[model samples]
Target: MQNDLMGLDSVLSQISDVRQSVTDMNAISIAPNPLSNGAVGQVSFTDIISNAIRNVDSQGQEASQKMTAVDTGQSDDLVGAMIASQKASLSFTAMVQVRNSVMMAYDDVMKMPV
Candidate 1:
């Protein structure tokens, strides 16, 4: 029985190692995205902001749909619904924070007695 348990542990360890290796490979497969010098000519900050806002809006909509599913008893996973709601809420809060920081910085710059 001791040998059996050791064999089982060995198998589990191998499985865990394989899983980590796969995850690492996936991370390496996705090349790093750097801001190119010509990126401004191709895509402005407004474009990036607009894209991000659109994505956040889409996520919010999906979260609402997930919530609706839960309310209608269509979703079996309440945790999944809750996670979606939290993600949407966090994304929205982040965007609001970003906006507030930018506004504050602009006000500070304007107030500079040059």
Candidate 2:
């Protein structure tokens, strides 16, 4: 029972790490610059979205590699691989939720009067 609890704790820790990454991605903001024409920060919306997609993709690839390694008897950390797979799944789900919200907002705006 103790080992099971420890495993659960480790999985929870991994989940929090994924959540932190998502939070950090959302925390991107435009910083004020004194030398520029009044344009926003260098980071654009497209760049942020693209970077987030790349990050999620990398995590998924890493999880797949871990699973393959475990299956081939190259790695003994099955629990770690499962945790990584769950983390990747959660991140992908979060990204999908964000995309859905964005689409809903866009639809709402399109329905508004000019």
Q: Count of backbone clashes for each model? A: 0, 0
Candidate 1 regions exceeding 4 Å error are 1-41
Best by lDDT: 2
After the best TM-score superposition of candidate 1, give how far the Cα of residue 73 lies from its true spot, in angstroms.
1.4
lDDT agreement with native, every candidate: 0.84, 0.92
Q: Pick the candidate with the highest TM-score.
A: 2
- Candidate 2 structure quality by residue, lDDT tens digits, 1-114: 999999999999999999988877844558667678766665678988999999999999999999999999999999999999999999999999999999999999999999
Q: What's model 1's lDDT at 11? A: 100
Structure candidate 2, residue pairs in collision: none
Show pairs that collide, candidate 1.
Answer: none
Give the lDDT of residue 29 in candidate 2.
Answer: 57
Write model 1 residue lDDT over 53-74, tens digit each, in one string.
Answer: 9989998999999999999999
